[model samples]
Every structure is written in C-alpha cells, then in structure tokens.
Target: MDIKLSNKNLGLTPSVTLSIDAKAKEMKAKGINVIGFGVGEPDFNTPDNIRLKAINAIENKNLGYTPASGLPELKEVICKKLKKDNNLDYEKENIIVSNGAKHSLYNVFQAICNPGDEVIIPTPYWVSYPELVKMADATPVYIECSEENSFKMDTEVLKESITKNTKAIILNSPSNPTGSVYTKNELEEIAEIAVENNILVVSDEIYEKLIYDNFEHVSIASLNDEIKDLTIVVNGMSKAYAMTGWRIGYTASNKSIAKVMSNIQSHSTSNPNTIAQYASIEGIQGSQQFIEEMRLSFDERRKYMVDRINNIEGLSCIVPKGAFYIMMNITEFIGKEIKGKLIMNSVDFSELLLEKANVAIVPGKAFGSDNFMRISYANSMENIKEGLTRIEAFLQEKTE
Candidate 1:
C-alpha cells in the first residue's frame, strides 16, 4: 500500500538553517572541524541564576503540567515585562505562553488567517514566516527589502502590498538574517498604515535585548493603543537569556485573540514545558547583567565580521544595527566556478562552501533572498575569525 501525504505539507521545505546546522554538527561528530554560521541561536550557556531555578524546580519535583495558556504567575510577570521594557500594558488575559516564539507566531497565523487570506511578509525575512503562513492555509505576499534601505520595509511599498484580502502583516525588528532594527519613527508610520488598513500586525521581537552600539529597540505596539489592539507581540527567553533549549515564548494580544490561540494550543501541545516556563519567570525577572555582557560580546563579533567581510574580495554586507546576523552579499560571485563547481546561486555557493571549506551556512534563498547569505555572529571570537578566514579562502579560489 502507498501512503500519500496531505497536500498542505507537500510543498513545505525543511529549514535551510537547521539543515546546515545539523550537517555541521554531524561533520563535527565525525572529527571534522566545521565552523557553522547556520544556527541562529545564542552559543552561550543559559544564565546561571535561571539554570539554578530550573534545577530547583526539578529537585522539588514540581514538574506538573501547566495551564494551556501558561502559568498565571508567568503571564503576570510577562505583562509587567511588556509594560516595563516595551512600554506596552497587557493583562494576564491578553497573554499566552507557547513552546517558543516560533510557536507563538504559528498560533498568530492560525488564529487570524483564513483560507486564501493574504499575510504580508517582508523579505529577506526569517525563513519560517512564509512556510508558517502557508501552513495556516494563507497566502504569503512578499515585499522585498533592499540593501539601500537598510533592509527595512518602505511605508509606500507596504501600502502598495496591502489589498482587500490583506488580513495581516508581520513586523520583525532586530530582524533575523539582516539584523535590521526598526526605529520608533518608522514603526509610527507602519502603525498608522496598520491602523488605517485594519491590518493585524504580528510583531516578532525575540532579539530585543541583543542590540549593539546605540540602537534602541522600539515596540511597534507601544506607538499607540490603537495599534496595540491590532498587534500580537511575540517574544521569548531564547535570544536574550541564552535559553534556546528552554522552549518558552509568549504572545500578548487582545483577549479574544489570546483565547483563540490558547484553545488551539490546548488541543495540540497542551502546555509548554512546566520547568522551562518556571525558569523563564526567573529569566525575565532576574538581574539583567547577562544581557549587556552578551550584547558587548556580540557587538565585538559583529564589528569584526563586518570589517572583515567588507575587506574580502567578492563579498560585502551592510553593517547590522542589532541581532547576531549579517547578510553577506554574494552577488559578484554568483556565476563563478570554484574548483569546477559552478556557482549558480546562493544555494550553490553555500554547498560549495560547506563541501570545500568545511564551513556550513544557510543559503539566503531560504530567507526569501538569493543574492545574499546570512552569517550568525553568535559563535566565539576564535570561531568567527576562523570561519571568515575559511569563507574568504573558499571564495578566493573561485575561477572561470
């Protein structure tokens, strides 16, 4: 007997980031020295205090399942965090903690999207947004963000993308793949559009605490109460607290939306891990000294990668304001042949890099842009230096 899968998932491609990261790990396990820029997670250890809390919970054996919407105490604290850090007030009823920020986004799309509804996702976006939209049976409309514009969406372009079927739009600041931070002024304009168009704005702010230099992260929901009602703010402990494995993320939205998401999550995963949720409470409320130190270290790596990538032949990148990624432009090397392997696109470029240089990186095609590739700078300084060196050498050897 033959089993055919559902058509909805037939077109879904595996995540290129995870694919490359896993390959690198596999290669490393086989004794290969692979430097991978494919993983988007922080490479640091989870903060000691937060880990200690997890240990305490485990020791106490309080691992009972949490509420489908998450622990009441955690929701209350998340509300305070919103008001304190994001300048947005949300009650416990407006919050729903899910497995991760990714899950929160999936719920946001599922809660709002109907069949054939259009969700405007800007590119080069995080690789998962369009797929998640598709998974929700919604159409993902793309708006290309250019290097000239610092990889941010133009208000005019956004206006053009919205049509009658446009039900929602995604806004990611300290954005993945580009490290572009949306300014408050820019958000005000987008908020105006969203409010005028009655579009639900799903704002992903997972990298809010990983900023560098003087960049201030502005929550689009904080622009005004009107936009706040239409916005679902997604965040988690992953990036800021080096807690990727913790799998705790949350969404703050209107009560109705939160309720729908909670109901959906209730039947699916039931609740996020009980211990991780408890640990996240401490991750947010505990001392934030770890954030600054992580930021400084990331800033150092960011500076080094930007300067080094720019100096290398056939590669250039815009300096990112926040997040741990750099979108390295590989346009000049697109059609070159390296070791008789033709470089047709970013995927080809990445494959050759991985095979020849023993370095793993996700192709930008996975992120809705093919002229570039993303490099995560969350690796150690030594790894960053060696990885760039390997990339430079790999590209340098390209011939006709």
Candidate 2:
C-alpha cells in the first residue's frame, strides 16, 4: 500500500532556531563542548513565586481542565495587564488563551484567512510567520526591509502591497531576529494605512518586556479605536516570565473574532494547561522585581555581544534596541574561503562555524534573509564569552 502525507504540511520548513539548539544539545550529550546561541528563550528559571504557586496548586487543588477560552480570573488579569502595560482597555470577552503565542498566531490566521487571502509579512521576519500563513491557506506577501532601515516596514511600501485580496498584516515589535522595536510614530503611520485599507493588524508583542536602550514598545492597536478594532494583540508569559515550557499564550481582539477563536480552540486543544493558567494569574499580579532583574541581565548580555561581534575581524552587527537577539552581518565574509569552506551564504557560514568552532547559531536564510545569522544573548555570560572567542578564532582562519 502506498501512503502519502498531507500536501499541506509537506512544504513546511522546520524551525532552524530549534533545529540548531537541538543539534548542539545532542553534541553536548555526546561529550562535545558546543556553545549555543540559537534558541531565543531566556536562560533564567521561572520565578520562585510562580513556580511555588504551581506547586501549591498541584498539592492542594485538583489540577484539571479550564474553560475553553481561559480561567475567568486569568482572563481578568490579562485584561488588567493590557490596560496597565499597553494602555489598551479590553474586557474578558475580547480574550482567547491558547497553548503559546505561536498558537495564538495560528488561531488569528485561521480565524481571518480564506483561500488566496494575502497577509503582508516583512522580510527578516520570524521564521514561523510565513509558515503559519501558509498553513492557514493564505499567501504571505513579503516586503524586504533593509538593514539601513533597522529592518522595519516602510509605510509607502506597505501602502503599495495592499490589494482587494489583502486580509491582514503582521506587526512584531521588538522583533525576533532583528530586535527592532516599532516606535509610536511609526506605528501611527502604519495604523493609518491599516485603518484606511480596512486591513487587520496582528500585532505581536511577545518581547514587550525585553526592551533595552529606553526604547518603548508601542502596540499598533493602542494608537486609536479604529485600529484597535482591526487589531489582534498576541502576547504570553513565555518570554517575560521564563515560562516557555508552561505553554500559555493569549490574544485580545474584537468580540466576534475572539468568539470565533475561542470556538476553534475549544474543539482543537480544549484549553491551555489548567495549573499553568492558575500560576499565570500569580505571575501577572505578583511582585514584578524578577522581570526587572531579567531585563537588566539581558541588556548587559546584549551590549557585550554587540561590542564583541563588532570587534571581531569578519563580523559586525547593528545595536539592537530591544529583545536578546542580534542579526550578525556576515556579508563581508561571503564569497570568501574560510578554513577550506567556501562561504556562499548564511547557511554555509553557520554550518562551517558549527563544525569548526562548535558554536551553534541560526542562519538568516531561515528568516528570509541570507546575508546574516542570528545570535541570541540569552545564554550565560561565560558561554557567550567563550562562544564569541571561538568564533573569532574560526573566522581568522580565512584562506583568502
């Protein structure tokens, strides 16, 4: 019998960030000393208070399923968080909690996209954005944002991309690979276009708390009532609370969209983890000292990485205003020979670095740009120091 897999998933590319991290872990298991700057998750453990709350729930209360949307208390806390942080007022009816921010994104696409609908995604985007759009049966239109522009979408380019078939546009602040935070002024411009075109804006603010250099994270939805109605804000505890494994993310939108997402999640995953939902309540309402400390640590690491990468002979990167990642420019080394390997693209550079220097990183090709590689400063100070040192030595071995 000949069995075939679904055509929908066949074209999906695996996550290069996770793939590199996994390979580094495997090498470490085999006694190889590999330094990884691949995964974007914080290296810090979940805060003591939040973990204690989970323990208390597990020991005292019955850990079971929650409402398809979320716990009422948790949803209330999320609304309060939105009001406090983003200056956006939302009621419980406007929220839908999912397994992770990625899940929230999936639901947003599925909720709005029909066949042939176009979602405008900026280049050097999160690796999963285009794939998620494709999975929703939508076409992902790209606008290549250059490094000189800080990798942000241009309002004029955005205007030209819109069409009758345009359904939505994704806006990621403190963006994943580039760490570019959208300013309030820039958001207002995009919000104007979105409002005029009646295009939905899926504003992803997962790195809102990880900002550095006094850069403020502006939610496009919070700019005005018109854009707010056309926006779905996605956020979660994974980045800020070091709760990646807990699998909790949420979306805030209009009631009609929220209801549709809630219904879809009801039959699909039922609910996010019950215990996690309860713990997230404490995470939101508890003291915020941990978040401050984590942000300071990430800022320090980010500074060190930017300076160190720039000092290295063949590598340089722009100073990221937010998030823990730096898009290291390797264009200077392209078409050159390094340690007997011809560096043709980001993938070639990354593979050779991993094999020669034992330092793992994600190629920019994964993010629709092939001239750079993404390095996360989420690793320890010692590991980052050692990894960059190794990289410096490896690049110094260039043959031409």
lDDT tens digits, residue span 1-400, model 1: 8999999999998998998888889889999999988989888899999999999999999899989989999999999999999889889999999999999999999999999899999999998999999999999999999999999998999999999999999999999989999988999999999999999999999999988779899999998889999999999999999999889999999999999999999999999999998899999899999999999999999999999999998899999999999999999978777889778999998988888999888899999899999999989999999999998887776642
lDDT of each: 0.93, 0.93
The reply for model 1, stretches above 4 Å from the true place, is none
Error of 2 at 267 (Å): 0.7
lDDT value for model 2 = 0.93
Where model 2 places Cα greater than 4 Å from the true spot, the runs are none
State the weakest 10-residue window (summed lDDT) of model 1: 391-400
All candidates: CA RMSD in angstroms?
A: 1.0, 1.0
- In model 2, residue pairs whose N, Cα or C atoms come closer than 3 Å (at least 3 residues apart or on different chains), thus clashing, are none
Candidate 2: deviation at residue 238, Å?
0.3
Q: Count the backbone clashes (under 3 Å) in each candidate.
A: 0, 0
**Using Cα atoms with residue i matched to residue i, what is each candidate's TM-score against the true structure?**
0.98, 0.99
